[model samples]
Target: MTTSPPLIISVSGIRGIVGASFTDDTVRRFAHAFATELPMNARILLARDTRPSGENFAAVAIKALAEAGCHVFDLGVCATPAAKLMVLELQAHAALILTASHNPADWNGMKLVRADGIFLDAAAGRRVESAYHRSKRRTGDGRVESVARDDVESRLLRRILDVVDVDAIRAAHLRVAVDPCNGTGALFLPRLFEALAVSAHFIHDTPDGQFAHEPEPIAENLVDLSRAVTEAGCQVGFATDPDADRVALVGETGQPLGEDLTLALAVQVVTERRKGPVVTTLSTSQVVTDAATANGCPVILTPVGEVHVVDAMVAEGAVIGGEGNGGVILTDVDPGRDAAVGIALILESLARNGRPLTELAAALPQYSIEKRKVSCSEQDLQRALDGLVQRYPEALRHPVQDGVKLYMEGTFQCPWIHLRPSNTEPVVRIIAECEQRQDAVELCAVAEGLLRGE
Candidate 1:
């Protein structure tokens, strides 16, 4: 999964090895394809993460968009969510963020965002893909514009501040530790903390793209971050990928709280003050269900990916929705998954509750989540799913949606196994969550058995 040099195109976006699959030609062609759909004189927002190959790819994209007769607004070294907010705040026609997110340092990609601060939906994604193959460039020229970096950070931070209580957070005098993975998050997190007047001890705070560790912010990769939380005497620790869209947390006890808690904790903050439905994907943790239900809010489960979660929130009028991978989509601020907003919500939750983050996290119903993956072709994954359905006839099968989601609700206590092919990679992801750790692990074993033709 580390820079395999295989180009992957999905609803998630386009990702590949920097020089191999994701080349100058790839960026130019994709940008041209995206530009073909835009009207002349359209103001386009362009941003990139701190990846080594990001600037080169961004130049290719800027050239393509400019050649297409669109006004290009370049906000250098900006997080994915910040760029998304810039699109809506500046009223840009569209936006392109050059980031592979948690992908390896050698890998790079582009996330095409709409003007409303959300990623492209299925229909729009197809249009961009079709344009890439068509390779048609609109005949004309436009100029590139530059935005002040301070201005860029302020706009997104203001949106999050508007939705959260700054006075409450400042009064808590909470000290927090943050690990931005030396990505664009460093450009955003510090400023937001300063605005909230929260005490933050920041590590890996440079944006040079030299990641201090594995960039995913998972528990295994966050041991250093976990240690820093207790070492710094902070209430909580936060980690973000290069783009800062997804955020994982570490508790005051020097424990990795897992990425799922990011959304669950944010839901605790948002729903306590405001009332609205909660939205998330099938891969999200069961803790979210417990939190939402306890608050008298219904949960809408969508397919994997933040775009689907955002779409469901828009349709259902949900206040907050995001993927389980440390993404919190606050619809009130921007539809994108913003770690900046996640930070605000977490601080506000601690401030309002007058409790440590450890207690706040423990207050949520505990659940065990086991995540595993199998490297196989898509057809092979489907074959395994079919075999699984044949073996477990009692399970409810959902075939037409994202993947094979087998629900075991009536007999089991909210236990489910969702076996879905990875849209961004050539593999099948097996996610199982339940009230017990053994039950979650057993569910994964069931999928593994099916994959092994047991």
Candidate 2:
């Protein structure tokens, strides 16, 4: 007997470990299911990251999609955001991106983007999921063509340049270091740097999927990037995940800035130029709220997911929006989160203010946010959440969307904890933030104790 590897299917799309639960058969099934949702002879964009499995998966996806009666235009080995942009630029019916974004090297899966160039919302995702399970596959006559789509990359870079003060960045003569973790960012960053005339030092610049370190780009995984910034005497350092859809930062002092700050800084920049609503997730730090508040921009809180943020952004006419996990969404450039956009915004922030990243970060409102995960069965997790809700009856509960977020004393700047299940893994996430680090740590401990029935 063999156990099946877990496959994560949600509004985020289907993802699983390659050669495990995610096989050629899995791709064909989802491809066929997605094809059924579109019209006959629909135009579809296909792209992938630099994952070693991407090539084979793309081949399978192209053939599967083509056979299912959708025209497949393959943009081989491109970033995830670029694929989303191409979906809109070409006015395609939809897109299939063959990359398990931010997942491990052995992981490869597909992200299905709707005609609007955004991930399908929960309703749309459910429709696809229902089709996938029915074992009904659609077959139609279509063609597969390999496309360069250099215009996608050019347009992405061009939009970044257009949104920022290009002359200011050039005059600053900024020196920066980057670690793409040997993924698709390696292919885009050089062009961006050349266009900006900024000096750059790159590590793991290869487009191969061999990650030099753990690929999440969080502080713990960015030791090399931190050291590179300090040793190279660069003004800042950046690290992007495998697909380059997200990015994290290191300041001038060789210290890794938390992922939340990436959105905070981006918010600061965008809200300064345009005043509108800012959308983000509940798990995001209050620092982002503070940044937007300082700029007199209203903030909208959504459930914890990129699609949630993007949906709220579009509905609210948001000037900027993203999740706290280093994903920044600027509608002017693209509806999806783009690291290239985040990079340019932060650089422009530094250049416009004529200050170092460390100083700029230090000037932000202070808060301590801690994120932790614990292995939990669904039954136990639900019981723990119920227990916590009862245990803290006085805590003001925000509307339960994806999870439960309880604000201590129903205050914004006070301590708070959010308990939610992981979308991609088999665990429950405990995110707590407070003015003091120890308070946040204690909050997480409390959540963990309840989760364990302690």
Candidate 3:
């Protein structure tokens, strides 16, 4: 038996700070739990970002998989999407990615992938968690030393190029700047841009597990990337978190565009080309609907999280879908949140339209989204959500398994508030978006207060 680290075990997976909350034993136990979910002689894909602890965790994972009688395909230091793609290609029974995503450099975690190349849905995630609690251990002789594939980058780019207008983008010869924040994206984004013939200036491109700035690609953390775009004389700038699953872009003239534009632009591109349903999360911006409506396509709203969005997209056969956090999931190419796919789609949108990213974004509906993060115990997270519902009795609630989202009545706008527990941390994420920024901020503040019992 091992002492459990101070970890946040949610549907997204297990997350904890390295050397403290994420200890070696926790890694072994979680790996064991994940391996228990696999069948005998199952093949598993294992990968990670550039976090310093990644190799150590991967080592632990290899041993656990080997002991569980599973053949492991170790894709060392690859993007989250790349790991999932390999799972689909290998017909593996399951996959695991060691990445804390946008969390700080000190944090590390795991993302469990199913055989379908998607993260396990809520039910399956719960089963894995249950297996963890039950100490489900499988003993068998697997392999000790595993071979790690090096072609994950090229394989991922192949899918992107196939879905996008490769030639047009190459012809455009657009200049772009990117900040991968010293994570796994540094391994492939530059190469992908070079393959597309797009001139790219990469900052923090070294895969040393050292973050140059805050890992989240939000506006506040992208000042340097925005400046780099201007200094490099680039048309746009790009930023990706550690795992490179989400991408935030900077428009021309070195201005930070909201992360929402990534999905909005991708939605616009797809809906204009194909008239179909657009699936997105409840927490996403209304720009999705605006883009969808312009092309005579309806928008379908699902719960927050990549799996839920992908599940909805696959079930509905939606042409495009993703989250507002700069995640773009093109079902034709991939059904997961992928920054690489988003970049390709956005670049294609730029190339086909012969317009700037700024102009393309300006053409969309203008809405303000205010987000607040509050650290809370799991009990308090639920209590706050319950309080919000009690406060607004007449509000319409959305059906999302992870969080509580309510459309409240207001004079000018019916603000929607999505209150959900963080998938990666011990915090509650309160997001409110509306046509007016002030309204959204106020709603977010009110929700945060309710959650805090103020």
RMSD of 3: 2.7
What are the per-residue Cα lDDT tens digits for candidate 3 across 236-266?
8999999989999998889999888899898
Residue lDDT tens for model 2, 10-108: 777788988988999888888889999999899999998999988888888899889989998889999989889888888999999988888878788
Task: Give the alpha carbon lDDT tens digit for every residue of 1-454 in model 1.
Answer: 6645478888889998877898999999999899888898889999999997888888989998999998999998888888888888898889988989998888889899887888898899999999898887786778998999989877787788899888998888889999999998888788888888888999998889999898998999998888899899999999998999888889899988868999998987888777889998888888887788788888888899888989889999998888899999987787789888887888888889998778898888888889998877666777888887777788776443877777676342367888987866657899988888899899899888778666
Candidate closest to the true structure, highest lDDT: 2
- After superposition, candidate 2 runs with Cα above 4 Å error: 1-5
Candidate 2 lowest-lDDT run of ten: 2-11
> Which portions of model 1 miss their true places by more than 4 Å?
1-5, 398-400, 411-413
Worst 10 residues of 1 by lDDT: 405-414
Q: Per-candidate TM vs. native?
A: 0.96, 0.98, 0.95
Which is superior by lDDT, 2 or 3?
Answer: 2
